[model samples]
Target: VRLSVPTGFGHMVMSGWLIEFKRQYPDIALDLLFDNRVDDLLRDEVDVAVRVMSEPPQQMVATELAQVRYVTCASESYSREHPM
Candidate 1:
């Protein structure tokens, strides 16, 4: 499978899912690509992708893997100086 994932993808999948996947399907070859941009399906650049998009693209079929949350953090001094 040609898997296209984000450049900064979490290690959770790599550490577990991918390990098990390879173990279960040792014969199936895998091409792992890391990039932020999504490739066109017509081009056949990748068969599967994992992206952290705010909204799904109109042209592609997407499934909700998980809901993402945002957090802001600052140093103690900086936070005190710049109160929200």
Candidate 2:
């Protein structure tokens, strides 16, 4: 099965998990396509797309695989420089 994922997420927290997935599902071929923009599923370019935001098309099916908590942070130098 083909899988399309954002380059950002794959490189961050997701890459390690995907490596485990690859080891488990060695029999199945996984095509990892990374892009910044959302892909058109109808075009058959991507069978599945994983993104941080929920943007599934109306005609397509989407399942909430996981929920992520958000955090807002800034560096000490940046904070001192900005002085907010």
Candidate 3:
């Protein structure tokens, strides 16, 4: 399988999964690519891409593997200056 993943979460999150997947599917070959930039799915650069986004692109089919929640934080001074 050709897999494209982002740099930030690639090694941190997907490494474990890739290990297990390889163990289970030892016969299948994998090509892994890491980049922060969004790849063109229509061009078939990668068969699958692991991305963190509010929504996936319109052109491709997606399956939600997990949901990520982001917390916004700031210093006391910055928070005080920009009050919600």
- What tens digits encode model 2's per-residue C-alpha lDDT throughout 21-61? 98998998888888756646657578777877756667667
Question: How many pairs of residues in model 3 come into backbone collision?
Answer: 0
Superposition TM-score, candidate 1 onto the true structure: 0.80
lDDT of 1 by residue, 1-84 (tens): 898777765354444677788999999998887767875755857888888998878998899777777789899999899996
- In model 1, the worst 10-residue window by lDDT is 7-16
User: Relative to the true structure, how large is the alpha-carbon lDDT of every model?
Assistant: 0.77, 0.77, 0.84
Which prediction has more favorable lDDT, 1 or 3?
Answer: 3
TM agreement with the true structure for every prediction: 0.80, 0.75, 0.75
lDDT of 2 at 37: 64
Residue pairs in clash, model 2: none
Against the true structure, candidate 2 has what lDDT?
0.77
- How are the candidates ranked when ordered by lDDT, highest leading? 3, 1, 2
lDDT for position 54 in model 1: 82
Candidate 3 RMSD computed on C-alpha atoms after optimal superposition onto the true structure: 2.7
Backbone clash numbers for all candidates listed: 0, 0, 0
User: Which residue pairs in candidate 1 collide?
Assistant: none
User: After superposition on all CA atoms, what RMSD does each candidate show versus the true structure?
Assistant: 2.1, 2.1, 2.7
